[model samples]
Target: MASAFIGSSVKTTKGPSVAGTLAETVAAVSRWGNQPSSEDVEEMIRDSALARHAALVKYLENKLAQAKGKLKKVEKALAKVQENLEPTELPTDLETISDEERFLFRKIGLSMKPYLFLGRRGVFDGTIENMHLHWKYRELVKLIVKRKNIAQVKHIAISLEAESGGVLVSVDKTTQGYAIIVYRGKNYMCPQALRPGNLLTRRQALARSVELQRYEALKHHITDLQERIELVTSELEEMEAGKKFEVHKALYSKFDDGSIPNEDEEGEEEPFSEVEDPKSEEGKLEGQSMIPADCNLRYQAL
Candidate 1:
């Protein structure tokens, strides 16, 4: 008799499950009796297994093709991102550079033309960019990069000679911000993300130090000159005021004090004067002496 459930296994060569009748069972039994030999069944099973493997291999091949296509697309996207991250193409015309570009170059230095290129845009506008900001700005490397435009740097470091004190500014093309590595002590540093580091190398530190020293010297000199000018101005004003006062005093003494030679007492022993001479202490100025310091007088018997 046929099993109640026939063709239940869809994975088998048969289709969906079906109910079997007695007549069907009898026919199945007859076919089963006339079925192929055991050797033939074994061969068929082996062939079926091989066919399944072939189908699976076909499916895997299709999947692999799809994966390859997807990988190609991913590679394109990655390439685009990398290209954007890379430095901008150097403008061909540095000599005829734009006003903005020239300004940026001048701000850094005139010699830093080689490394200066119209870089990939930042959050702000402007084409010119600092190449070393992507890594480090070493004085020696800076010179080289200015000429060669290609140099490898390991760390975004800034070193000062004798004593290590300087700022390290690093700007990687990948990151929006640069790092500021300030040397606190002998072997410690805080790699803080903020303003650009002062310089990436010792040579820059030396140059910067010299510049600051010169600036300080100039400032001091200016201050000294200002002081001297003020001192001289003060002396001049005092002298002018004293001269005006002395002239006024001489005029007043002549008119108001009546300290003129008298015609009636032409040979008078005592000089005629409305104001009396006052006694004076040594090194002290007496008030209303009624006679000028340079005045000459001749006295005779009264």
Candidate 2:
């Protein structure tokens, strides 16, 4: 009985080995002979897939590099805009310029009065309309100086209030020494303390104010737009880069799994075939026939 059991084991083992070897050989022939054209196409397909993956990698790298450059450029532009937006303090003392030095100021519809005062009274006062007109005069004077047509003025003074309570202006000439007290629409010659200087035009001052304000506003708007663009561009680049990385990973996995045909080798090892059970139905019948009568019939048949 022991010898019989050993023999049965040997048979089982030998049968599997012979069948496995036959199956391997048959599989090899079938793979080689039946689908040569399809195999070639599959190889080409795999090569194309690899090429596509490589191209994608290169594209993603280039995009990232470009995005970095663009981001840098945007940053520089934003910085420049911010710098330009900052308020520049005007000099308390006006710098002298050539007769041709000129600046333009747009009109802001405000009016002022020109006045001169001596002691507690006014010498001359007049209504001046439009602030931009004063700015234009100042610009013209600077331009004339820049062109060497006129000397630079050193001082400017203007009375902003009524002459009785305003500052004094004095004019001196070869034959006449005069003091002026000027308020809005009124002028008087009076003896009082005098303040001597050139005065800025109201038009010019208003124009400068408007220009400065507009410049600041435009700078802020540009800065905000640039920042938003930078954010969007960065996000887009990141998303595209992530997608590219995922595709590369999947392709690499495929290559590793041998799903892609081996380009260097003409052939590869065949996959093992699955074994099907022929006695499955018989086994089920025997399992169900557990009664004594069924067992006796099975013994008689054996």
Q: Estimate TM-scores for all models.
A: 0.23, 0.20
- Candidate 2 lDDT over residue span 32-130, tens digit each: 876558758655655554565555445444544544554565555545433322222222332222222211110110011221111111112221222
* Residue 132, model 1, lDDT: 26
lDDT of 1 by residue, 1-302 (tens): 24545545334546654458677788788877866888797556555543433443344344345435544654554344333222222222211334454334323422222332211111111111132233343331121111112111111121111012222222222111111112122233423432333222333333333444344443553454344445434433554354333333332322221332233432223332333222221112122222222212221111
Model 1 off-target regions past 4 Å? 1-33, 87-302
Overall lDDT per candidate, in order of appearance: 0.31, 0.30
Question: What does the lDDT come to for candidate 2?
Answer: 0.30
TM-score of 2: 0.20
RMSD of 1: 49.7
lDDT over C-alpha atoms for residue 19 of model 1: 55
lDDT (Cα) of model 1? 0.31
